[model samples]
Target chain A: MKNLWFHLMPYKDLPDDFREEHPSVWVDIDSGLLDAERVHQHYHEYLDELEFAGEVGFDGVCCNEHHQNGYGLMPSPNLIAATLTRRTSAPAICVMGNSLALYNPPTRVAEEFAMLDCMSGGRLIAGFPVGTPMDTIFAYGQNPSKLRDRYYEAHDIVMRAWQEPETFAFNGRYNQLRYVNVWPRPVQKPHPPVWIPGGGSVETWRWCAEMDYVYSYLSYFGYKAGAATMQGFWDEMDRLGKDRNPYRAGFLQFVAVGETEKEALELYREPAEYFYGRCLHVNPKWASPAGYQSEATIRAKVQSQVALAAAQSRAGNGQNGGGRPGPMGAARDWEQILDLGYVIAGDPDQVAERIRQVCIDLNVGHLMLLCQFGNMSTELAKYNTRLYAERVLPQIQDLFDDRWEDSWWPQPLEQPATARALA
Target chain B: MRETTISVGGHPVRVLTGGDNPSAPPAVFFAGIGGVPTWVPFLDRLAESRRVIVPSLPGFPGAADFRHLDTLLDWVVHCVETVEALDEAPVDLIGSSAGGALAAEVAAIAGSLVNRLVLIAPFGSHDTEDPGADIWAQVPGPDSIPNLVCERPEAWKHAWQVPEGAEAIDYQVMHTRAMEAAARYLFPFGDTGVVSRLHRVDHPTLLLRGSEDRVLPTSSNERFCAALAGPVRTGELEGAGHLPELDTPDDLAREINAFLADQELG
Candidate 1:
């Protein structure tokens, strides 16, 4: 398994009464709640922590884009990735990525990704995400119904701009460019490997399969809730007559490993609670705008809810994620999170065991370890990264590498230790 | 009323027409939130004297997805093509809620086809200050309309009468389908650049608001009134909410008739 350290530079100083005072953590997160000075402090701290991941032997260091969100402070992952490129010599500088649809002429993505690749010496894994409805639809004001269309068009333009030999004029419904040429062409042949991070959209599954690109499930709920989506993706790959190469898939899991299980449980409880409870308190409306989700997905969601409701009634679970929030949403405690497998919390042995199970079961070659989550102190995050790198990485790093060659990973990921030494 | 399909830019559009007389001026009614069913006795009442064309804008009920429309301006082109196909004089247009936003766009660009435009709680743009509550964000299941759409609980019976053995999930699919169109045109805030182009709407227009419409409070419409250059009048439907035609159809019809009559004779 290719273990990569993921950073979601979240605001750490939300008041204790945030759930009661603020209605949401995304889109409409109250500006009054943010302390600019503290954010400045957190930025430097988070960057230092991200830099530490490389020193601690993480195969890669990743950053992602989010807008108007308290949890994800990087609206422009490219900028952060650029900063990391200079400070760190991690095997891969994964920018998991710029929301492709948001940029007017998506050639911007091509140009930037090329710059990052060149700067990082061909060590950039490009992540093209349709983005969360809150980020793309609500925050940036893209039409949800047309978001995917824009995303596909943007993806096409970015690819052509990177790979095409000559300058080309592209005419698309959403984008029209008189001159389509990208300068500072990527260091990698053709372009850096593209990793599409999807949030359980079947359309994404089909697109990724057709393109033969990596279809990464950037799930918050870990393997338990994410199993269906992962299975669905592999099932899609099967339908498309594609091989079940684990390298074609990736999964993001929050992990908290310490010297002992009790140490992990005690150390991570507050941050985990802060992350899951306060960071995910998004308004239902903001989370899912009309047309953001496909019609089939909508129907499937409703049917699943109905099925879940029936199952709940049969078992008297009385859990509704919406409205009453009986046993779901931001109100969930750390124990609940552990029970649901949202986080893998234990000693290195236990953490390695659970993550290995995730790799084997989900058939994911890339395991994105979310070591730095909501409000984790820079000290704690660095320690978590170091612990995982030292104790757990040896256990699971070879899970699928012997069987499958991961084309989606940066070239350095092939010989990360050598790459690090040379750098 | 007769339901028919008309080609708008090669995409077959679902349309319902009634009172189609050769000489009578056309009065096209655009369904507010969902589709043709949302507008009840008001649509029938308008069709009594003139041709009332209610096309299920793509992704609403019988219509296909609105993805073909491309941009918000494409919707205006679709509306223009729709009006040109009417084969009648400038029609009086009535649009409610989400439909009102589209109708407003049509009136701003294709004012030649409109004698009078009536917008009922239209949402076409976003405003940072008074970002109205999103109806889709709330829980109603696909099978039923939210109570906020109606001022009185009993008012819902006039429109959303659930059929026997009807699946709530089906309605949920329809609800999402309708929302896809609306969110495409007007997301977060309902403000399209119509405010800048309001001068193009040379016809008399009436902006009607529901007294209890929390979804789109009337206070947020100040910019719209200021932007409108023609005899842009504002009125309130006494006890209605966002979807007046669903409940106060008679009252809505009376207001529409009063406005159209005065605009016609004057």
Candidate 2:
């Protein structure tokens, strides 16, 4: 339960008042604002926090891959992970990795991840996500219909490559392997722990539940949008009769804390706006292509948008939503975002309590917090990171310790010969 | 861990690197023409402690094939950028055979990014006195080795084979096509022109050659050392062919270990 993961990003730097006037995502700004020097400095700052996070007792720090987007600013998370291994000790190196299907053969992922695991002394947690349709279909030129199958096949090949002791043969629809073996197998026995990050899709949730892998809901659309999806996941676990284990689930949230709520809000306003407005400005072609998303998921997105509109209408009254922040109160106005307590922006005490309340409300076992969002300065991000590490993390360290008794929920399993066999 | 893949100029390239060691600078090893990463032995040795990366060229064994890559400079820039992205910045480069050509171009263009370079039997140009590259196919024999310094002509007689052009390897057909591609783009020998630019390279460089290399003469390696602007060092592995890492791994490893020992991991 003390495993607090931080998503540190180099936000597009802007003036303090940028957010007050513009209610958009921080990444929407032009690329001219960022230079190699700024990028270099920002990288060191984030690394400092990762080291600080471990020193403060968090089990790991998290970095992810995104390309041609401003929201996260990390086109190559492995680069960040490589640097992290030298900068920090004690924390596991977690990369919510390169999209499997987007890669050819996928054994490259196996090889690199194995290398990271070895270099880190077996403290590597590998993540596989059925990549976003936009990046998959448009950017990588994968077919939407075949995306799922390719992703699954890539995952299968990677796993086999990892577990196989010697060369074996594998011939699949997408990949053919006459000899299947990767040098430098992961240091962890039968490979390190595998976590599947999800975007609240039915297929992902069901698959994670069935496979008994950790389901990290990278909460971007907020808690409300995720409510039904998580319910479906838990319900599947119930039907499968798998005893509930908190380790099997995790969630991500954007967090910002200051000495006072006013100061925090003032600091967060501009960058938060940039994150929502500029960075996330998705071309409809990329974000929601025709036939890209399933009908059910598309409907959910539309419904979420409607809810956002209604909330914004209510917030226009200029009064908080009956003590709860209205759509505009704390929503940050992300596109179609259902602000269900995913974000915490306030003073240390207030934000800490908010985080605790959200964790309890969501029953989320793992909390991967994003301390740096949008174009927040490196110094400010470090301040938030230190404050959380020193002040807030201690408050909720025991929220889920000994919370589950399901010893069989998802214990490490010896690799079966079939799965380990060459492709 | 799964293999990491990225695209360069619409070509899918796979990169496999050693562990996360920020203090340790990254090193890139290029695949042989028509070759993938799994072909070499030194790949493992290079990845031992340093951050090492290798990319699959698009038209290799199983990748989407490109007709020919005319300019070695473009390929070099692509490789440098790919390596930079992997290490979050610049890195050292290692190349063998034709890959050595690409490595030299990368060092010339993105000179600042390369901390050091180790080129093995690099193929670009020889002096006017040396026989020009045969457009047909290359024949493999003792003489195919690039850095043979044996004074006894009879000793190298058995090692040298009759001149044969592109028909030497299974990838000869692809090399023929690549030659056509180069013909289309007028393959630039600018890397040779920029030999003096090697002095501009702030990082130290070590050139490794086989003692009995026939493809590239020992003089070429010596000229490479003299032309390099950076601190330059040269070494020859005895009883080695062009591919010494494959024929004599221990001697090659010892030479590399000796060179790397002098530099900081940073």
Residue-level lDDT tens digits of model 1 in A263-370:
999999999999888888776656666777888887777676778789788878786432112112534588888887888989999999988998999999988889
User: Fraction of true inter-chain Cα contacts (below 8 Å) kept per model?
Assistant: 0.73, 0.00
lDDT of 1: 0.80
lDDT of 2: 0.61
Task: For model 1, name the residue pairs that clash.
Answer: B124-B190, B125-B189, B125-B190, B125-B191, B126-B189, B126-B190, B126-B191, B142-B171, B142-B172
Per-residue C-alpha lDDT of model 2 across residues B53-76, encoded as one tens digit per residue? 676554543243343233445555
Cα deviation in Å at residue A145, candidate 1? 2.3
Off by over 4 Å in 2: A11-34, A295-342, A405-423, B1-266
Every candidate's chain B TM-score: 0.88, 0.71
Top candidate, metric DockQ: 1
Docking class of 2: incorrect
Backbone clashes counted, model 2: 51
Query: Model 2 over residues A334-419: C-alpha lDDT tens digits?
Result: 32222344457788888778778766766677778877777777678778888888888888877777566422121222431121
Q: Please report the candidate that would top TM-score against the real structure.
A: 1
Over the stretch B120-219, how does candidate 1's per-residue lDDT look in tens digits?
8877655767777766566433323556677764555545555679876676677678767776666646666777887777678888887887688776
